[model samples]
Target: MSEAAVPDGRAAPTLTARQPKAVHSALTVLEAVARLGAGASAQDISRELGLPRATTYRLLNLLVQDEYLVRTPDLAGFALGAKVVQLATVAAPPARLASAARGVVAETRAALRGGVHVVFFAGGRLTVVDADPDFPLSDAVRLVREPERFAIGRLLLIDRGAADAAAVRDFAEFGATRQLGELAPAYGCVAVPILDGAGGFAGARGFSGSRPRADDPSDVLTVLRPAAARLGPLVV
Candidate 1:
């Protein structure tokens, strides 16, 4: 919270600050649920985004009412609602590419020790096209909230030339490795870039996993690289 000066010299809360922040948190809650993929419970959203349980439920119910989210038949989880899909379709570049790579993405996710995700940049924001429903590593909320903190997000940032000097140097040295406790503290992640048919930067594919020991840095290249190679030529 920031403070502003009043005539009485006492600190006053900035006007309308809390409202926008709440709005941001509500949106982040949605992203976290999306990343959690299939069978995500309300508790899962709360934990991932560090939001209060009451707040999480409020946001979830609101989105559900607005049709931005849909509850599962068994009432065990949540998925993107029809209205959300309708909105995404408006400029959803990754839709086709995301669909085509599903098989490979699943295969890659299975081959690895954790959940995998396919991300693309659209409308100046990152979107998670797909995630391993059975084993989501990190919540999507983190990816959307502070993208520069993760491997895939950093890759996208660097590509757009939006990264700062320190970030670039750090990426060069560390590559795309977001160790557990660093970002989610409960999971680790690694990413590889995907090129479009023209061989330019198109998107990113990566996986989240259990935090590895110091000797390892959540390396997924052996599996992710091949997946990207198999997927790159097809996205066009």
Candidate 2:
């Protein structure tokens, strides 16, 4: 309000809020799309973000052109694109592989809508490095008692023997599924291994959502494979 403080004799403009409207809008749009996950249409994003139809299409188009999002095969929906996954490559390095995977785990949960966990062997004890607070393993007690039933426990035993390794190798390479009793009688998981730069087993990453009978194995693998691959280099 002080004229003396004004650069050109006009009273200084008052700041009403933090961050520019465009920048804020873009971020909200991005977040909405991320939560909506793959196969979400522009209409879904527009509704979720309370954005105008025109603005939604504009943002979607821009994101697609920039590769932050990709049009589904039918060209009727959107999914996370390469540019989005590349962010994991630059995730800040942490003291251990688990710590480094924290951020990527959050992204995985949002994309898969399930309990996303990252575990690594540290100091001879297998530890959970990062997990989505929103999606805890359906039955933690049962999971501990029965490791062979779920993907997490099975993947962890991957080093048991050459025969066991061979049996699970294909599963880990392409993502493996877990039955109810192996994890939880109500839910299951699809997991893949995380390898270090030396090609050693670094950790495992996966999602536990609906039961296998409820969700397609291929769909779960589609999300987990890329996520595990993306976190591989960063953790290694």
Candidate 3:
């Protein structure tokens, strides 16, 4: 009998299946702690995940012991640990931010046929969170370590005098007015501040494209301001 025609019985290869429930439970706990921002109590976790108090406590203790979570000195609550941040720094994917900004970024890319980048400020530097692939400008978009030298960061700081209170004030005013400008000769980007629910500057959203095809800085502002406004709630 041919191998294809034979009805011989053979054992199927065993494949290990992932425990999604456990993974989801851990993720739920982590997200709860992150949303609480800094310190979250066991009761808070239980309420957030709708889990039994004992189970919440047990998981919290395990996470804390494993260094994925940290217990406050008073032991009243828990927060994410340095190890967790480190792990996130290395292994965490950019799916959430990418997903959230996909529509806006796609629209900008379609309009400009250049790159659109969403950046977050941290440790006195801008970090590129996501970008479009068809951006016609240089490939500097992939350098995620620090964005201090990038046009997006510079333009975001255009009002801050690069790093001064006056500049910050200028930036705030410009953000309110929705100004646009060019960062380099061949590259121009439009930036608008992402504001939090309480109206604080969360970060900046920017769109970049080829100098030749790039719209006037003012036009860029008009295109990006609305999108940035919509992104504020997702920042925190």
Pick the TM-score winner. Answer: 1
Q: What's model 1's overall lDDT?
A: 0.68
lDDT of 2 by residue, 56-132 (tens): 99978988788666675447777665455445323433334555566676677787776787766333223455644
Worst lDDT run of 10 residues, candidate 1, spans: 210-219
Model 2, residue 186: displacement in angstroms? 3.2
Candidate 1, residue 123: Cα displacement in angstroms equals 5.1
Q: Once superposed on the true structure, which residue ranges of model 3 sit more than 4 Å away at CA?
A: 1-95, 98-100, 136-148, 155-184, 212-215
* Angstrom error at residue 1, model 1: 43
Taking every candidate in turn, the Cα RMSD to the unseen true structure, in Å, is 12.7, 12.4, 17.6
- The list of candidate 1 runs beyond 4 A from truth reads 1-94, 97-100, 164-180, 213-215
| Residue-by-residue lDDT tens digits, candidate 3, 36-145 | 74446898889988999987887788887786777653467776664554444454333247466667667765665445667665444444565443342222321233
lDDT of each: 0.68, 0.62, 0.57
Stretches off by above 4 angstroms in model 2 are 1-100, 122-124, 139-146, 162-173, 181-183, 213-215
lDDT of 1 by residue, 6-117 (tens): 9999999874757897778878977786788635788999899888899889999998788677675457777666455445544555464446677788788778857677
Order candidates by TM-score, high to low. 1, 2, 3
TM-score of 1: 0.58
Q: RMSD in angstroms, candidate 3?
A: 17.6
